[model samples]
Target: MSSDLCGSRLFLALPDDILTIITSSFSPGDLCNLGLTCPGLDSFMSSHKVWLFQCDKLGLVPYTTLIEWRKGVFSYKALCRFLVNIQPMIGTWVHRNPELRHVVYVMPGFLSVVGCRIIPQEIGPLGLEDGPILWTPVFEILCNHVGSTSFFLHGKERGVDYVYPGLLKSVDRDCNVLLLEVEHRHQRGGGKLADLKNFTHEADNEVSSSQRIVGRKWTEKPFICLESDDRELLLEFVTSQVRDIVPDAANVLLFPRPRIDAVDSQQDFIVLHERRLLLLQMYERGNMNHDLKSDEGSPLNPTELGSSEISKSVDCTCNYPASQAAETKEFYSCKHWPYMYESLSAFYKFPIRAPKACDEEYAGLWGGTFGLPPSADKPGKPLFLIYISYEESEGKQQMIANKILDGKSRLSPFNGSTMFIVNIDEPSMTIFPWNTDQQSNPISVMQSFKGEGICYWSRHRYPSIEPGSLFVLENGLLVYLWEHAREVLTLKRLYLGELLKRGERLPSFPPVLNFAHLTS
Candidate 1:
């Protein structure tokens, strides 16, 4: 036999248990590649629970755990704890080397474990306190990216780190809060008091330093003013590191904040240039003088006031009938209040057209047409309504009801009347008349049965009652009653047919045809 054929035969001959063991020995990538080879191998690859267990040991289990948790099958708490336990290790590494720490902390999967409990007992003493430590994965991940040294330096020098004290204070008051000052002090070799003074002097003397030096100074401070290049680099690092840990995390945090210095500077520069151009236009038009004259009777020089100010003044009064005649063509088209308001209202009104079916669907449903009437003092007939309960727990049901009721001015018209039943409950029957209008006498017999009802069927009670026994009534009558009556008539015809087949004949002498007796 050929060597390839021999190998294929050998592989095919191996037991599933043995194949699983061999596949488990391969890396995740290798196993993934092997899984694509053949149907038999794919089945073996999928069954490789031992390989998954190994992945868990290497901290890859959390992703699997996350998927399971999303499916509502398992708790993510343990995975969270695992992430939390590893956080300090990351912190320790970052603290030792500040430069690459930011790259490490914001790495994907770092903060994916937020809300996980860090058990001090399970993790060997890195001197963490003896309590359940819950870390915000996002903050910790961000903290990791901005290394301890950089964070301390920034907090002490620029006060930028103060934005997170509210978030980080609960975790470790000393480390995230007090340690900030301590680290700052250590970095400065002087107190926070001295650092503030130095920072103030540096800000006041902006002209004393070159742009390169000023940029470096900003970097030294907690608030790093990122250039376009720096923003790109930061995003690139965050994306790459997140992809390494968890590809999904990279997608979320890759966008830079719009309010950052580089972005704001560009926007501000454009606005400033626009304002400067307006000023130059006013100078060219010879309209920079103020309208200081108190009397309106005095002749007004049309070009004396700045075009911008004249536009503003005319816009303020252009709506009045008295000023309408005096207003220039520019004032009419300048788009002050009436024109702007109308334009905006029109724009909003045009875009926010009502849904086509809203009028037809809601017209009668509201305004008391389909709503429940007041309860009656006496019920003439009992009506049973069977509804299924979808909620797993009683507490959950109440919570859902409260949430539904919140901010709602009207109760659901169908509540307790329409029998919004679920299919999961036990097969059972309830009888109640719909008597919501509670009029002393119903307009019609069927109308009297409108709203008075009771729900009894629920999937929670299934198997106790036979499935077909449960029935629903609309307008207090069974929908299948006519069919049932037809079946009764058919039975009578069958009885008469059988008699005829048996050679039985009706008597000629005055015999009474008792249909009631025949039906019975």
Candidate 2:
């Protein structure tokens, strides 16, 4: 007995389970340090399950991040080295967790951390362990869920009219349209559109003046429709309006008033603006596209060129010296040529195809009975049109009719399957699920129905639809649904109801999460 006996006497040993409980209470850094102190401690610390348990208990799960870190400090050099060494591992992580992937935008000092508690423990090994363990990646994943933002409406000081009709029609079946209006309070003096334009230009000259003008002159900011302007101004206005409704309305839709000329030309500035904003928001949220480059700086060119000049060059060069010409032709006809060109084009041009307008008789109708061809014998699922209305009016009626037509034409149901028409309207808002049968008139089945202010309906029944259900309102603002029935209702009951009751309107339509939210 010597130094070993003395050290052993001073330390109190506990069972493994009890020791784990004690260690779990330590901070992440401390826990890591304790694991390094002795062989026995290191073995326990390296356990993947142990780390997972710690994540659940302490909420230290890893998420996507703009930069990777080591120890407790910010390290760009470490991040660069990590990216080079573990790129394949990172790719695997992203593939496994597709929802967490995003395009990371960051400044030098700014940091955003995303945490995930549900990670599997087989990816990588902690240093203390022999095999792979699920250690939090250097960067965290960001979670962007819906219902995180709010909306509100402000009316003219004289008196306010709740333009429910316009609001109902703003979001179509595809969830692509956003109609917003910008009101100029000082324009009460009858300033011309040209005058407003000049005012906007002058205001842009100085940042302080711009802030003052936006603060004082722009009153009653609401997310009514999308507008056309310089990209920066459009972004600024959108961000400003969103701040009024939800200070963290990071993702939003800014609708500008309709332009009659643009509408006639089939150049929907609103749709274009929405797509642009969507891409920008995606970039901001860290959903970046990967780019692959060749080792040599060779420019890729297509072999089957569209124009006669290019065709001639290829044909003429076909008979040149075998060695030099063969290499030249191979360079031009590389498979990567077309893909690279298309990638560049996508960056500059609008990618979404504009919806072709139906004739006046079938305007706004989607594909089914109204203007669509007849369905096949064994049809697939029928398209569902769920309409929510708070009050009855001529405008509301028109909106409903327009939605029905649009859904019918676009969906184009087949023989067996029928389009389900659900409406929430009248003294007692009720859900009427109507499906087309062999007989021309569709059968209507009444589900849970009650109350007056607003109604919700869908082809699929959900738990939220109940008799005498008290629809939750936020800030005195009515709820508007986007995309499918479930998400729309979920958002409404959870976020919009209180806003409506409080007499507020959303400054902007919250941005819709694309494929991830839809499929999930």
Candidate 3:
């Protein structure tokens, strides 16, 4: 029997380690077929070691982290499932708004993945690699033991750090977009359960005092907690205000606010309203999904149906005082207020176009100059260079226009830079203001503004007194126009180092604001 087994053509005849490496070479789609060949082969193929190797090959996370992450998950196979699904999100993502070149680097964070934005900064001498990437906390997806995820957004204001919690939506293996949306959680689970539990316990203890005041108005009634219907009504009211503030808004209904009717006094109402406003603005500033320029590569709108289903599970029935309930409602409402506006509830869909994949036509280094139109008294002003690339994030293909400072040009270098992420399929992109109190939807720059030059380019009309757009010309040259085309910069594709060499250098931000300092 031993001789027969030894002479047989059996895959198990090879050593385990060697067999595992060989199995790892097969595509994941082929693993099931290989496993079904025989019981012995199935057992061998299903081994954790083989899947562990597969996970390592993905290179999204380190082997040590994968090993540690394994302890929290069911098996190496499940761990591999998580890693592959999140691989597309591990690269660099940028936005055209904010004029700060906000670059989001999605990396491994503990048992989950984190998307950290390199704060808008001035370019430093070290350049991209050696320069310390000073990044601020943006959003993170915390994985559960079962590989499910929860989303949390980070915010800082007045020296205080706040975590705006939400949930993961439409996250599948092929999902291209990562939507951190405000969802009502019926079950207390994940990393944030403890903090919520503690808050609930504290609410219970404080309810006695506030109940005395609230009991007087509703002694006869049961005084039930605010229901989903109540919150929906309040959300409708808030959304109406949002529409009034920004007429022709496209995705204003993305935020689902909860009604905090527990406000017993005028002070509570003021405090809660103030808190709500601040949280909503912060979420509006951070939630960039609606403003994304591309969606052609996206599979489906996962949030389309899932948001209502999950929001239905939201139960604010904690046994807290009226004031506490109000505060809690405010808290939950704010979660969706800021970043929750993911176009999940958008009535109108933005235009789509065939993507220009990061090919040679328009996906490399570009240099230009910005000045008044040639017809203007001063046609040439500042020498500018831009880096154009095709990037994918949240399941969309974007034409990213990133501004770079030129040190070799005759003009002094600019202090700040701008990045514009445009959808390849659509002829338009949104332009956001640098600093403004108004919460405006992205202004479409789909229309072309023809200038006196030999080239023709498209520009958008902005509400601001001074409007600008990254105008791409019929020629190879790219232009940046500001102040209604009064200031324009024409750029031709060139090497960044050469442009910096021939360009005059200027002072940039401090180490923290510049890429000189790295954040842990």
List, in order, the clash count of every candidate structure. 26, 58, 31
Better of 1 and 2 by TM-score: 1
Residues 1-520 of candidate 3: C-alpha lDDT, one tens digit per residue: 5665752235688898788777777876577687787787778778988888888998866686577567666888777766765665554443322234334446665555655544433334443323332345455555555555544444432233334334344444333233221232333453232333233222344334333222221222332332323322222221211111111221111111123344433343344334333334433353422211213432222222123222122221221101101011111211011122222211111111233554425665554443433111112233333556565667765555545343332222222233344454444342322221113322232233322221222354322224345555443345445534355555566532222212232222321122111111
Assess candidate 3 and give its TM-score to the true structure: 0.40
Give the worst 10-residue stretch by lDDT in candidate 2.
Answer: 320-329
Deviation in angstroms for 84 in model 2? 22
- Would you list the rank order by TM-score, best first? 3, 1, 2
Off by over 4 Å in 3: 1-9, 29-39, 62-75, 94-103, 124-131, 157-159, 172-176, 184-520
Candidate 1 lDDT, tens digit per residue, 350-457?
Answer: 011112353211111100011123221112211111111123444322000100000112222222122221232342343323333344544222211111122222
Model 1 ranges off by over 4 Å: 1-6, 36-39, 46-51, 59-91, 96-520
Worst 10 residues of 1 by lDDT: 487-496
lDDT tens string, model 2, 1-520? Answer: 4565443232325565666676667755575686777776666666544444444453221322221122212232222322222111111101111232211111011111211111121112211112211111111212112101111221111121110000111112222112223322223444342232334232344444334333323322331122222212322222222211111222221212223465532343334334333433543432122111212321222211122232122211111100000000111211111111210101010011122343121112122111111111112322221222222344432112111111122222211121221223322242332244233544333322233212234443422322231121222211222222322221111111111122212221112110011111
lDDT of each: 0.23, 0.24, 0.40
